[model samples]
Each structure stands twice: as C-alpha cells, then as structure tokens.
Target: MLVEVKNLSYVYSEKTPFEKQALKDVSFVVDEGQSVGIVGATGSGKSTLVQHLNGLIRLKNGKITVLDIDLSAKKPDLKALRKGIGMLFQYPEYQLFADTVASDVMFGPLNFGFSKTEAEEAARRAVNMVGMDYDSVKDRSPLELSGGQKRRIAIAGVLAYRPKILILDEPTAGLDPAGKREMLSLIASLKGEEISTVITVSHNMDEIAEFSQRVLVMNNGKLLYDTTPSELFYRLDVEALGLSLPHTVRIVRLLKEKNIILPEVLTEKDLVAALLAYAGGRNA
Candidate 1:
C-alpha cells in the first residue's frame, strides 16, 4: 500500500467556540500505481485530508501510514516523508519564486540534500520531464514564461526530488480549455514513471471522471463514497449530493433516453467508442 488512513479525524480550533470537524472517521487505502481522485465542494476537507499524507497537517486524532512511515509516531520523519511526495497546490505557478527556472527547479533537490551539481542535474531532468527544454529556459526568469509554461516549471520544481507520490490540488485551475486538457494529459503521462501513485483533488467533475481510476467522494468532511469512477459517475446520486456529473456522463444518460444505451463511460473518447460499437452491432 502506498498510503493507508484509518479512522482519521480532525477539527479546527479545537476546544474553542469555533470548533468544527473537518474529517470524521475517514478510512481509505491507496495502492501503488493507482490514480485516485478526491472530489467535494468547497470546504469539504478534500485539502485537509491530503495535507495529512505528507505531514503538512499535524495528526491529532488518527492513524496514517504512508510508504511504511507511521505518521502518528512521535517526531515522525517529516522531511523524509515529504521527500517522497510532491505536492502542487492550487495555482502552483504562484509558488514560483526563484529568479531563474534552474534555480527554482533545483531548490527541491538541494533542500533535500543533493549537491549543487547533482541538484542541477536533477533540475535538468525534471525540466525535460515537464516538457520544457532545459537549455532554453534554464537561465530565463519564470515570470517571463507563458502561464502554461510557468505552471509546468512549477511542477518541475516538485519533480526534481523524484517523489513516488504526486498530489495535485486544483491543478488545472485558471487555465483555458486547451490548457486544462494539456495539464491533464501531462499528469496522466507522469503516472507509473517516478510517480507510482497520483492523488488529485479537483472541483471539476469532468477532470475527476476522465483522469481517475478510483474516486473518493467527500461530503461535510466525511468520506461518503469510495468507488470506481465509472460506478460513482454512473450509479450515484451525485447531483443530489451537490456534486456535478461529468459532461460525458450526462451525454451517456441522454443517449440512453433515445434508446441508445451505452456502458458507463467517463471520457469523451470512451463515449465515442461505445457509441460506435453500439451502432455497428445494430447494423450487423
């Protein structure tokens, strides 16, 4: 297992008038090579839950074991734990601070104890991994790049450390339609290559449906459902739970009304393939 959370619970402003529970008896396991999506409305504890995986949030009332490191232990090796996980928060591009791309991307490895030469080497590889030419952008300021390029460079910074688990929160936020698709494709390509597991928290149902193999639905800081994307999108009363269905799911439902039933599909490509097969079978 890459990560395991058992009976995890957390409260904000504990023992105060503003006390509010963020997670209640949450439990889940993320296995290696799994692409998991966490979905919920704003303030539903999606972010809070992920923060615990890398020791960003202190564990007060739960058990979490990630990569064989017990998070609830006294003085957990957070630095070591964080070194194996790369986290990109909402608008990760905003986290870029170094004057140059090389400097920014090299920071992670250097901070993790890599030598200067080694850090630069790692930075170069990470930049190429993110699809940017290291030679061309190494000395250039990140602020000079386009929005999408800036986002990729920011991701390269996290990739420099070569984390096994990658967690992205609102990764496609503030991007155009094409940018969103590009970002999703980039993340999809990263799976199983230096990143064995991916945990993404997105408010976009379409993204969650298309990208995730498994889905975790959170409601009011609680894990309401843990199921496949196909099952969650097809079988759940997601709308009633204040969650929107993917556009492809809606299209599938519409086709069903027209007597063209298709199997549960999460992406546009799958929907198209299913429709084609149905039409061909009828013609035969």
Candidate 2:
C-alpha cells in the first residue's frame, strides 16, 4: 500500500465548547500509482483526512502511516514525511507570495534543504511541466497573471518537491469550463509521467467519474463507501454526500428506464456517441 490509515479519528478544540470530531474511524488504503477521488459535503472531514497523509494534522485517536512514518506520534520526522507527500490546497494560487513566479515556485524546495541552483532548476522544470512560459512569465508577479496561470504556479510549487504521492483538494474549483478541463488533463498527465499515487478531494462527480479508478465517499467524519466509481454512482445515497451521478450515467440510465433501446455507454464520449446514434436513428 502506498498509504494506510487505521481507525483514524480527530477532534477540534477538545475539552472546550468548540469541540467537534473531524474524523471517526476513517480507514482506507491507496495503492501506488492509483488515482483516488474523495467526495463529501462541506465539513465532512475530507481535508482533515488528507492532511494526515503528510503528518500535517497528527492523528488524534488512531494511527496513520505514510511511507512508514507514524503520523499519530508527536515526534515523528514530519519534515521528511512531508517531503514525500505533496498537497495543493483549494485556490492554491493565493499561497503565492514571492516577487516573481520563478521565485514563488522555488520557495518550497529552497525551504526543504535544496541548494539554490538545484531548487531553481527544479522550479523551471515544474513551471514548464505545468505549461507556464518561464522566460516571459517567470519574472512576472503571480498576482498579475491570469487565474489559470496563478493556479498553475501554485501547483508548480508542490511539483518542484517531486513528491511520490500527490493530493489535491478541489484542484479545479473556481475555474471556467475550459480552464477546468485543461487543469484536469494536467492532473491526469502527472500520474502518467511520475507513476505517483494521487488523491483528489472534490464534489464534482463528473470529474470523479472521468479521473479516479477508486472513489471514497465521506459523511460526518466517517467513510461512507470506498468502491469503484460505477458502484457508488448507482447508489441512491450518493447525492446525500453532496455529490451526484455523472451526467453521462444519469442520461444512460434514464434512457434505459424509459425503455428506449440503447447500448452500454460507460464513458462520457461513449454516451455522446450513443446519443448521436439515438438521434440519427429517430431521424432516419
């Protein structure tokens, strides 16, 4: 397993009025080079769970070990543990604070014991990999760039670390459709290139269907289901977690329900082709 969690639980502000349990007995294993999607409603503990992968949030009740480091303990080598787990938070672009894009992307490696030359080289490579123009855009202030560019630069920061496992929380959250599509493609390519484990947390079911091989549903700090996308999308309670079936699945199922003849359409592209055939057959 690439990552493991055993009976993990965490509460905020224990022994106080603001106390709340963020996770309860959440357990799952992610194999290396696999893409897993996490879905849940707001405050469902998705963010809290991924933070434990890098020892950011210490496991308060149970145990979480990533790359063989005990995150539940207080004295683990967190810096080393974090070095292997890269996280890109929601609206990561806001984290950029450097004078230039190149400097901003280089900050992470520089902080974690990389020489200036090596860190700069890594930053350049990451920026290019993320589809940024280093010669022109590298010197520009990140705040002055377009929305997609800023987002990419933020991702480049983590990519420079060259972590083995990548976790992104709502990577495409506030983007136009074109930008969202491009971002998702970039994310998928990362898995292909590095063979790294990826876990994406989001409420976008369409993205979940298109990207992940496994899906994990969370509700009220408990893992509701950990299964394949096809299995979970058909469940009636899927929307209870603030997620809905992919439009392709919904359309295909509705046609079958109405007794309209249709072939199996598993992917979005397949569904589009089926719909085209359905239209053509009717017209003919």
Candidate 3:
C-alpha cells in the first residue's frame, strides 16, 4: 500500500462549544500509481481527510501509514515526509509570491537544498511538463499571468521537488471549460510518471469519472463508498449520498428509459460513439 489509514478520527474545536467531529473512523488504502478521486458535499470532511495524508493535521486518533512511514509516530520527521507529498489546495494560484515564474517554481527545489543550477533545471522541466513555455514565462511575474497560467505555474512549484504523492483539492476550480480540460489532461499525464500516486478531491463528477480508476464518496465526515467509478456511479443510491451521476452516465440512463439500449458511457466522445453505433445498427 502506498497509503493506509485505520480507525482515523478527528474533531474540530475539541473542547469548545463549537466542537464538531470532522472525521470518524475513516480508513482506506491507496496503491502506488493509482489515481483516486474523492467527492463529497461541502463539510463532508474530504479536505480534512487528505490533509492528514501528509501529516498537516496531527493524528490525534487512529493510524496512518504513508509510504511505509508511520504518521502516528511521535515527532515523526514531518518535514521529510512532506518533501515526498505535494499538496495543492483550492485557489493555489494565490500562493504564488516570487518575483518571476521561474523563481516561484524553483523555490521548492532550492528550499530542499538543491544547487541553483539544478533547481533552475528542475523548474524548467516542471514548467514544461505542465505544457508551458519555460523561456516565455520564466522572467514574467506570476501576478501578471492569466488565471490559467498562474494555476499551471503554482502546480509546477510543487512538481519541482518531484514528490512521490500528489494531493489536489479542486485543482480545476475557478477556470473556464477549456482551462479545466487542460488542467485535467496535465493531471492525467502524471500517472505512471515521476509521481507514484495522485489523489484528487473534486466536486466535478465528470472529471472524477474520466480521470480516476477509483472513487471515494464521503458524507457527514464518513466514507460511505469506495469502489470503481463505474460501479459507484451506476448505483441507484448514488444521488441519495448528495452526489450526482456524471453527465454521460445520466444521459445513458435517460436513453435506457426510452428503451434505447446503450452501453455505459462516461465521456462526451464515448457518448457520441455509442450513439453513432446505435444509429448504424438501426440503419443496417
């Protein structure tokens, strides 16, 4: 297992009147090179759960082992653990602060003790990996770039150090459709590459179904379902858990209602192909 958790529980404002249990006995395991998508309604503890993966939130209760390191251990090397896990929170572009894009992206490598030359090279590679022109954006101020560009640069900053696990919270938030597609493509390309695991928390069911092989559904601070996207989305009770089916899946269901039998489809391209095949068979 690349990541494991058992009997995990957490509470916010433990002793205060506003105290609330944010997580309760959550447990799951992620294997290396697997892309997992976590989805939930607001306050479902999705964000709180991923935070524990890298030790950002102390393990007050339960056991979490990430990459064979016990996170529940006292005074574990959090700094060292974090070096192997990269987390990108919502609106990560706002975290950009360096004088230029290259400087911002190189900051992580430099802080990790890389020589300036090596750090610059890593930054160039990271930027290029995200489909950005390094020479064109290197000297430009991050603040001056468009929202989509800023997002890519912010992701590059995390990629510079080449973490083993990457966790993203709404990485495609606040972007146009085209920008969302570009970002999703970049994330998909990371699979089986330098990153060994990727976990994404997103509300976009289409993106989750399209990118992840497995899906986890959370509700009221508990994990309600963990299974393949096809299985989870096809369940009749999925909407009852506060998650809608993917657009393609919903369309397939509607077609079935009209007695037009079609196989499961999860993407626009697949839907088009299915429809074309159905038409051809009828014509034949």
Number of clashing pairs per prediction, in order: 0, 0, 0
lDDT of 3 by residue, 134-184 (tens): 999999999998888899999999999999999999999999888888898
**Candidate 2 residue lDDT tens string, 1-284:** 87889999999899999999999999988888789999888899999998878877766788788887777677988888877888999999888999999899899999889999999899999999988777788888999987887888998899998988889999999988878977988998888696478999988888888889898889999998999887887655676667777888888779889988676554788878889998999999
Query: Candidate 2, overall lDDT?
Result: 0.86
Q: After superposition, how far is residue 34 of candidate 2 from its true place, in Å?
A: 0.8
Q: Decide which is better by lDDT, 1 or 2.
A: 1
lDDT pick, better of 1 and 3:
1
Off by over 4 Å in 1: 278-284
Instruction: Report the lDDT tens digits of candidate 1 across residue range 1-284.
Output: 98999999999999999999999999999999999999988888999999999999999998999988999999999988999888999898888999999999999999999999999999999999988899999999999998889999999999999999999999999988777777888898898776889999998999888889999999999999999888887888988778898999999999889987889888889988998999899899
lDDT per prediction?
0.92, 0.86, 0.91
| Cand. 2 TM to true fold | 0.94
Each prediction's TM-score against the native? 0.96, 0.94, 0.97
Best by TM-score: 3
Kindly state the number of residue pairs that clash in model 2. Answer: 0
Report how far off residue 225 is in candidate 2 (Å): 0.4
